[model samples]
Target: MTDAQLGLLVATPIIIVFAVALRRMGAVRTTGAVVAVAASVAIAAVLFFTQ
Candidate 1:
């Protein structure tokens, strides 16, 4: 796999785990999770397209 794909594969799970941890710790709400996922996806998309 390409670097972008590898990055997405790795970062997506980390981001999701962070979001879940934040929610459980009351550091973030549902909206925060949504935003985090959206931002991660957007970044992944940029990496994918720019590569």
Candidate 2:
């Protein structure tokens, strides 16, 4: 895979963990955290394939 793809793959779990913890900490609303994570993953995926 390309560097961007690898970067994204690695970032996925980190983002998920951050999302969960942030939600628990009340730093991010439940729905918002999930949505944010989803959007981040999508952006990463797009960047991966495009690069």
- Consecutive 10-residue window with the lowest summed lDDT within model 1: 42-51
- Runs of candidate 2 with Cα error greater than 4 angstroms are none
Cα lDDT tens digits, model 1, 1-51, are 787788887988899889989988999898988899888878888887777
- lDDT at 11, model 2: 89
TM-score of each: 0.72, 0.77
Clashing pairs in 1: none
Worst 10 residues of 2 by lDDT: 1-10
Name the top TM-score candidate. 2
Cα RMSD (Å) per model?
Answer: 1.6, 1.3
Off by over 4 Å in 1: none
Q: What lDDT is obtained when candidate 1 is compared to the true structure?
A: 0.85
